[model samples]
Target chain A: MRRVAIVQGEYHVVYQPGVVISTLLGSCVAACLQDPVARVGGMNHFLLGEPGADVPVNPADMQRYGVHAMELLINDLMKRGAQRSRLRGHLYGGANIVAGLGGIGTKNGQFARNFMRTEGIALDHCDLGGTQARKVEFMPYEGRVRATLVQDQPLPPVERPRPAPVAQPTGELELF
Target chain B: MPAASAIKVMVVDDQTSMRAMIRRALQDLGFKDIRDKAGPVEALAAIKADRVHLIISDYNMPDMDGLQFLEAVRQDPVIGKTVFIMLTGSADKEIVQKAAALGVNNYVVKPFAPAALKEKIERVFGELV
Candidate 1:
């Protein structure tokens, strides 16, 4: 099977069978969308929802935003013969991973959900926010998805002191 | 503006590579006192223990996101006026607005070059010498 790995701000569409799209996500969201009847599908990874009013965004980096990423993925899929009305989505990623960091993952997940709803796309499965990072694999042509949690490093074991040996009564009291 | 060598700056991010990248950028800009922490909680504590002139932080972090960290800094009397610059992967409107509302001095999107980082700092502290 052919495998394609996409990082933040990237999307891939496939109409051929045996093609898998994958990504590792942390505080980012990936949307796997497919049109079963048309046998076409694709995936997109976005870092955030949209650029703020005062924030200056370079044109080259626009696709990193959710708004543009979504549009581009959907449009690309449609261009490959996928129908917008028959679209189905499976959302993944958006894990916080760190305890104190703000909920960027949560916000990303929310944006994906809202976008799907507002665009009238049917969401069949979703595995969003949590404290663990995720690795998502999508079979675009088959419209099949598998999401697994990426394990964090385990804590080191604590060292315990060995018990002191009991002394026999030798009666040898040396004066200091 | 204080000399880059004299001004103490703190770079906070959960990723080690990101912290190193920012540290290297700051070093390239002739910044001497650059300290980094992996998360906002420790960064906040370090600021309270010893004041820094400026803070360059990533928006997505564990144990307190960048906005929360900014709010904590803004609410504190000692470090309330510190110049802050946010580093984010995306220029998401909500994150930007929130950071601005929390009194961020400026922000630089991720995948930025050293020159861009320097420009953002210059915007906050005037020309760096």
Candidate 2:
């Protein structure tokens, strides 16, 4: 029953039986991939789909991008004896969590779905796109996942009262 | 233009490992004056006490996130114009737009290599010789 928690821009692969990988998500995405035949699996958490062409990036930060995160996870799983053809994928997170933050969650979910489809990986389960944050736990060896909604929504910022306006002197004041 | 060795840089993050990593990268880039703070509050105080040329901060932190810190920096007249760079885990457009609105000079994604860090700084201060 060893537990491993990964934050944003990280991934974990496990072949042992008693290991569980976990992460919390808000406007982010996590992908769980496994091969039933090889009994190998892994999970990755990413912040966005792809960097804009203007962004200067390198290999060290690849995991923070969904396109690269998926590739890294699959490569790691294959290295551990998993077959790409036999890989089954489960997707989670991508919750909006907060309003006015844009639809980054929707974009992330779309990216994950498109990636699996383009890669020809079979999608076993998906839980994505809501206003609440989620806690996702994956049993990599078992190829099983559980997602729980942690909060309804983040509380709105408290409104503060504005100060009364100072009265301006009308016209020109006479020298006293 | 000040040389990299002359420019003072501050690295802020809750994780010591992340701060250390950023510091190492800055050092590798030839920066001599480097300071680090574990949270935004301490970082803000330090900046007011003695200003730095650049501030590189992580987006997610315990007391106050990077956005709030950016707002605070922008609101202060004395240090508002200092160069600011945000380190984020995501490249979400919303974050980019927000940071830009807050007057962030530049931003780098997490787990960046030294080369990328150099590029970001160079973009802000021009080529570091």
Candidate 3:
């Protein structure tokens, strides 16, 4: 099976049947889009939700943002002869791994949902918003998605020498 | 080059976890003065005030992507010579060539090990110890 790994801030569109596209997510969102009629599909992994109000935005950065990710993925699918009206979306990987960070994952998930609604695309499946990271794999032509949870790496155990056994004084005990 | 602890490094990423992960990795590698920013814009603002010796920035950010950020840095007079390492998930050859042309010192794909990060930095900055 041919497999392509999508990374953060990247998207891939596949026309070949049974080609698997995968990505690892930690507080990032990946949107899988497919049109069964044309047998074409694409996926995008985005790091941020949207530009904040009054914040500066560069057009080139749009591909890394959720709104742009969705747009790019859909456009690529359409370019491959997929019809927009028949597109189905599957969303995955928005986990709040960083504690006390104001819920970046939640914001990302919301943006994706809103974008799907606004574009009139059917969001059929989603695994989003939790403390656990995820691995997302999608077969665009088949429109099959599998999500697996990933746990954080634990620190390696430290090795320490056993303390030397205390020696008992034979003659007398001294008082401090 | 100076000791690893003496050099100042800045890490830019929109994801808090990414920033934290890089920071922890650097600390493990014996880098003492490490600063993290949420995006390229914030990193630029901080750079204007206090120049860092090295920058490890994520390719995708909200206000400015890594390419644009590298362009801005290259145009700057004060911090233009800072060592830069671009981090990304995709290893697109076109993007890599563009970054190399923009004066990026190195590139790292995601799911990398701390040892790999150390080796990459050492390739540009000499021995860590």
Candidate 4:
């Protein structure tokens, strides 16, 4: 079986048999859309929503956003002969691994939910929003989806150097 | 004087939002010399041009993954010894082992709070006082 690794901000669709698509996700979200009747499925990995004032200025960078990734994935699925009405969604990732970094995961998950709702696609399964990263695998031809929680193994402690002392101002004042 | 304010910290992530979030957190933590790059390639270029006291990099990127970038830094004589903290979504033991072998100073999982990031930095470089 041929395996295609989906990197961050990318998506792939498969219609042929014996092909597997997989991705590693952290705060990013991956939406697996499958047309069960047509046996056509695709997956997308996206980092955030549409670009706004704070987004990167490069137009190519916008492809990583949720809106663009989702559109690309959906369009590919339909282009591959999958019917929109038969499409089912499986959402993964959106884990809040960095608890204090704000809620990119939550936001991505919400975007996925809203995207499905707005597109009229049914969500068949979901594993989203937690502290652990996820590894997702999908067999598009079989409509088999598997999501595993990547282990949160603790790193061994290491010795660190003491902080260097800061230079202090001299008490004597000199006029220039 | 606050310790973190003098440190030159660079944040590298493919996602603009992640970079902005980390930059905001660093600013809130009183870090003054904070620079952000979109990915490892740009970050490497920046490091070659000037030195950064500490680096906070996302693990996954299109050009060079964090581990590969870390290894590259370790090999570089000029900026090899700079403190590096990896920001990853995966806590998998294998990745942790690889990072440790590559001499990463610390690892912070994704979606981390500003306080948590500060704590990790303090753990490596002492408190921000």
lDDT of 4 by residue, A11-110 (tens): 8999999899998888788999999888899998888765443322233344467765775676568768887778999999888887686887898898
The whole-model C-alpha lDDT of candidate 4 against the native structure comes to 0.77
**Per-residue accuracy of model 4 over B61-117 as CA lDDT, tens digit each:** 656889999999999999999999987542344666688888998877543445557
lDDT of 2 by residue, A36-155 (tens): 989999899888876543344544555687865775677568668887779999999887876886788899999889888766799999999988888889998887889989885443
TM match of model 1 to true structure: 0.51
RMSD of 2: 18.0
lDDT, candidate 2, at A49: 77
Cα error, candidate 2, residue A131 (Å): 0.7
DockQ per candidate, 2 decimals: 0.04, 0.08, 0.07, 0.02
Give the Cα lDDT of each candidate. 0.79, 0.79, 0.76, 0.77
TM-scores for every candidate against the unseen true structure = 0.51, 0.51, 0.50, 0.50
User: How accurately is candidate 1 docked according to DockQ?
Assistant: 0.04
Cα error of candidate 1 at position B77, Å = 65
Q: What is the TM-score of chain A alone in each candidate?
A: 0.84, 0.83, 0.83, 0.83
Candidate 2 per-residue lDDT over residues B1-129, each given as its tens digit: 558999999899765545665787788778999999988999999999999999999776657889999999999999999999988654445776788888899887654545667878998898996
lDDT-based ranking: 1, 2, 4, 3
